[model samples]
Target: MNVRVMNAAVAKTVAPDKPAAAAPAHIAATGLAVDFPLEGRKQRVLNDINIAVPKGSFVSLIGPSGCGKSTLLKVMAGLVTPSEGTMTVAGLSPQEAVNARLIGLVFQEATLLPWKNAIENAAFLLMTADETIKKSEAFDRAAAMLKLVGLDGAEKKSPSQLSGGMRQRVAIARALALDPEVLLMDEPFGALDAITREEMSECLLDIWERTNKTIVLVTHSIDEAVFLSREVHVMGTGPARIIETLPITVPHPRTEESYSDPAFTAAENRLRSLLIESHKKGRR
Candidate 1:
């Protein structure tokens, strides 16, 4: 379907609720930097990065390649330690939040276990991370999560039996099973076809609405960034740092109609301009 048709069809879907009070910041980074040692020299990846994401809000980090968007995400996921400065999730260090199952990460690839069935894959994290969760309970929770992601009848199927979207759904279910307070996704849908990508976007918004998890996404698509995020942070490369943080006021449960809205266009244009300027500076 065309964008307009899709918008009209999905227009009746209920929009997400707005937060009644000011929620506390769930993710905070101050002067964060990352560097790697290469050939007896330090290669800087990020520099003086700072951001604050309020609880239950959805945010996106967007910029050109090599801008450290993914690096910042890994820092928040406890997968990489910052070379300098400090960052926190829910007032706790990233490692602490990760250990408590307060942070969940989804990468570009689904990365499902080939041997495991759908439900098994979804329960993998719960079974391995939390010793207190019994096998049966884990399976039950996984099943519920899979259902939540629109895989109600595919529980017995293996990864090979599923489509690309279904496998990603399993991945998402697995992350949600952790009941994380914050979700960090790095280009999770970058590999999908255009139609499937759109479908997954809708799926994500529904999940976010129901769970109210604080999310920070990294993506190159301006439309995806504007459609899903309440705030879009634009970054620049040369030792990477944020250049602008634009609030998206396009309203909740955005449909195809949203892409044409003035607010969406404005956000997309602003981000594009910032990225172009960043690229120009990098070439200098």
Candidate 2:
């Protein structure tokens, strides 16, 4: 659907006089800034930021550890309110979308209940998000989501019984069970080993392609960003702001060989240089 229709569906708080062409972006921020009060001084974290994520797009925010990448993701998820500026998810306020159950979130840690098995953990989210779903139906839905994330045979396993990658898969399955229109992830695979990280990236790409959900991922891995995202929103440090939105032109259905392609290499190199510069600026 076009931006106009999307905006209408979400119903923005923007001025009615604003033309439809100037409607709120699928996910956007206008002069967005954020600060935290520390020691009687406002410590800014995000500065004069502006962004627009189109519908059904896969986007990544990449930067150094202190560069506010996670903060930006939090703002989008409505977990942390921005100190200034207006932001929207699908035209509605972040909290509005969140309350509407139109957005799902995944984080670095799986954050599963140790006592609950995989199916229970996944089904719990479905029931929590929508109380109308019956217990049996919730389990059925969760089972399907577990299968989608490639955790088919491990449905009855508790958190301790699963591998790190499998735990993350369960987290992803829980998020997907909500059937959200958008998924916001913050370093969801950051804790995994290198081999598992790469594997998860491929698995996530397959899911994104199949679900067509608007996704915003915050990660420190340039290779992961280039491989999985249609565009990478690189951020600068010291009250972080977006430095560039680099488009990844490499073909989709990306495989292990895709990493060696010149396009992917070039994109990775470009992001690396930009991040290096951002780090240097932070040190200055």
Candidate 3:
């Protein structure tokens, strides 16, 4: 399918800046490491990690289960602090970027409020974060976001009324309502069945193309990483670190048929090989 152009109405609502050829790094980390206390001893979860995600690009991190992918994402979100080196989002420290509302985060579960309807839940963060925003205006902005996420007519539906995929769409709408410059997702579609997972992948690509938001996704599925990312950062465990950065040369507006494209298959195979090799090394 051809990439859908952002309509003027949604364009005005988002007001996204088109990414320049020389777009600066939206998120960067250098020699980043994280440690946690285990049995009164410092356990290193990540080591010597460096990454640079250009503005408006889609990137994915894939690795073995215990390879610290989520932890690296948390460090970028400012939910966790790095024990060493530096991290930045939009040239500011992660915490500062978070304080400025430049970051939006979505996790494995939708985590919507049971009591609130779709629009209410989408507007919740904006209303709470900025006391100056009137509830009506927040709802209006949230309605637009819901529409952007393909949830226009379902605004009145409560979380319980939505399916797993629809609930995740609501969760994404909630994050987008902030109009954040960057979106960090840690396994956002991990809970869904295979077919829904594929559907969500397409939904996400459409959203990314329209919003031009710099996105970093942590996923376990190699096919997903191949299909969605401009570049896949393959990580290794045993003091988890990025071992390879594989660029996906597939042209954008990728469709379901892209799955069978030679480039897609090659990238998937390469990623699978890397993960298998890493697992073997970890066993040694």
Candidate 4:
């Protein structure tokens, strides 16, 4: 979209009121460092990492395993405290944002309740003490989100009864039930088969368009990252740092044919080269 080129028009109308606030930055992380105790010694996972996610933007965090991809995400989610640095969801602490029901996380696993139906599972977030999803209105909201993800008819089913991909769709619906300003996805399609993974990625893109929620997705696949994100954040291992922040350039509602587009292929190849370089440097 050449967001910079569209400045005047967007700055005046399009960008603002597109997502949560009037052109407010969705998420911003700066100088983020994560270290944990390991074998009686301190082990640094991420270091000197900085990234900013603009409102209504889709960003993919790609890195080798143990390179602190998930750790950085957790730091943004407020689940793990960073050793140093800062993170914000809509310019607020992740914890405070989460308390205000502004941050939504879609785990790698479904994490749905086996005993509850899709509607019930989505409503469960409302029972939370610190934050609420508004169970009364959550069911309809969840169903609409399901429809957005192309699972309109599956809302009556339970997690145990649904397929892996369908379950993940329900999980996505649950995440959207609260109308979150930012969606944090941790390789939600990593568990699915190849074909299913591609389908789920398309589904996610559809949902992203309908609601315009800012998304930060983590994945190990270059193709997946390139296909789904407007920008890709590639990281290196050993006190993980961002090796690259390549822009996707492709617009939203990407088609299956776009997968074969020259631009898409080029972006995928570039990210692949970066990943290989990371490996050559003794990184995962």
Candidate 5:
């Protein structure tokens, strides 16, 4: 796979003379910003952020800690309200989208219930979200989702019985059980070991391919972003804003061998350089 890095500015300015009609964006933000009160003063976190994620595509937001990458994701997930501008998920307001069950979110922690088994934890949301759904039906649906995430035989296992990676798989299964149109993940694999992280990356790619759900991941690892994203959006702090978007053109169904490919190396280097620059800018 030969990765081609496209500068966001150049791509925007050098559009096709007669651009073809494009599909509506699954998630979009215009002039998005967020502010928190600090010492009775407003502290801006995100500023003038704009983004469009094509339906069914995989994208990533990567930056230094506290760069508001996760905050941006939360905005898309309807967890946080922006102080300025607007955001839409699946062509509706973030809150509307959430009400419609069009968005699913997974965080760094698996947050599985200790007493419940895998199937029960996976079915918990479905049961709680809609009381009309019968327990048997929810469990069946959750079982299918667990199987989708490669946890077929672990339905009865408790959270303590599962490894970190397996727990995350259940977490992902729980999210997917909703059959959401978009999935927002914030460092879902950050706590795993190096090898497990790589494995989880492959697993996530498989899930994305199978489900074809639009995914926006927030990650601190450049390699992880390069491996999993169709485009890597880099953010700069000091009132965080997206500074660049790098399209990772590496071919899909990426395997372990893809990591050693020149294209992967190139994309990783490009992201690393951008982050280094952002870091320097943040410190100044």
Candidate 6:
């Protein structure tokens, strides 16, 4: 598929102007608006929002707290309904796509089943109550995934025995098992130590290169976004909206040495300036 058309999966509220008319998008959303009564209060959490994430691309959504970053992710995941607008996940509604098992999600916490060992936890997603892969197949696949995350020897360990980073790796492995066309990650490394977070970032980049699956990650770390994605969507402080889409031209496999590279520094500075300005305006 054409790269232009391949990247057309967008959230609702985006303009109708198509990126590549000759070859349309694999998935896209239009006029996506999400709102709800706060039970005792009348307030809106998200307004007309728009975004486009292309196939085999990695996009990060970064913004201040309570700006609906996670909520936006939930909408994309089809966990929350848009009060108005339309969203298509691989041309299917969110719930429909999820039921069809076309999506994968990695949350802030590992959320792995405590009782299950690493391999079982990794393949846990592949098994259905009524239908499941044979234990051998699950173990084989799980072992491969664990190996991908550098967790080979720990496959027999329980969640409780694993460190935070290990648990998150297991979570990522589980998500990849589904082979989702689009992976939705909500602050997957927020809880990890800076060192673990950096390690996970490199691991994630390696995995993305290997799988080439489209990923939409929600994170607070500007550096993380710059490091992990091809495009970083910076949102306005609140009434969250896309402020700017900073494309990382710095070639990937970006390493500790590359951090000193001018292109990387410039992109980080540009995003930081935009965010600082947004926060200022938010306060005003």
Per-candidate Cα lDDT values, in order, are 0.86, 0.86, 0.88, 0.79, 0.87, 0.78
Better of 2 and 4 by lDDT: 2
As for TM-score, the candidate ahead, 2 or 6, is: 2
Q: After superposing candidate 1, which stretches have Cα over 4 Å from the reference? A: 1-22
Model 2: ten consecutive residues of lowest lDDT: 11-20
Name the better of 2 and 5 by lDDT: 5
What is the per-residue lDDT of model 5 for residues 106-169, given as tens digits with 9 covering 90 to 100?
A: 9999999999999999998878778899899989999999999999999999999999999999
Those runs of model 5 whose alpha carbons end farther than 4 Å from true positions after fitting are 1-21
The 10 consecutive residues of candidate 5 with the worst lDDT sum are 12-21
Q: What's the residue-level lDDT of 183 in candidate 5?
A: 95
Residue-by-residue lDDT tens digits, candidate 6, 1-284: 23124224423112223332233444465666677678787566776566666777888888877777788889878898887777787778888888888788999989999889999999988775216568788668778889988899999999999999999999999888776788899999999999999999999988999988888899999888988887777777456656556677778678877677787788788778767877787887
* Candidate 3 residue spans exceeding 4 A from truth: 1-23
| RMSD in order of candidates | 8.1, 7.5, 9.4, 6.7, 4.2, 5.8
> What is the C-alpha local distance difference test score of candidate 4?
0.79
User: What digit string (tens of lDDT, one per residue) describes model 4 on residues 1-284?
Assistant: 23224333322222211232234567877777888999999999888877878888898999878778998889888899878888888888989987888888998899998899877786666556334445556677767777877777777888888899988888888788768888999999999999999999888887888888999999988888988898788887865787667778665569898888887888887778768877777533
What TM-score, to 2 decimals, does candidate 5 have? 0.93
Error of 2 at 270 (Å): 0.5
Model 3 C-alpha lDDT per residue in residues 71-105, reported as the tens digit of each score: 99999999999999999999999999988999988
| Candidate 2 local distance difference test against the native | 0.86
Backbone collision count in every prediction? 0, 0, 0, 0, 0, 5
Model 4 misplacement above 4 A: 1-24, 129-135
lDDT of 5 at 11: 44
Candidate 4 lDDT at 243 equals 65
lDDT of residue 210 for candidate 5: 91
In candidate 2, which residue ranges exceed 4 Å CA deviation?
1-24
**In model 6, where is the ten-residue run with the lowest total lDDT?**
12-21
| Number of the candidate with higher lDDT, 1 or 4 | 1
Ranking by lDDT: 3, 5, 1, 2, 4, 6
What TM-score does model 1 achieve against the real structure?
A: 0.91
Q: Residues 187-254, candidate 2: write the lDDT tens digits.
A: 99999999999999999999999999989999989989999998788887866887666778888778
Worst 10 residues of 4 by lDDT: 11-20
TM-score to native of every candidate shown: 0.91, 0.90, 0.91, 0.88, 0.93, 0.88
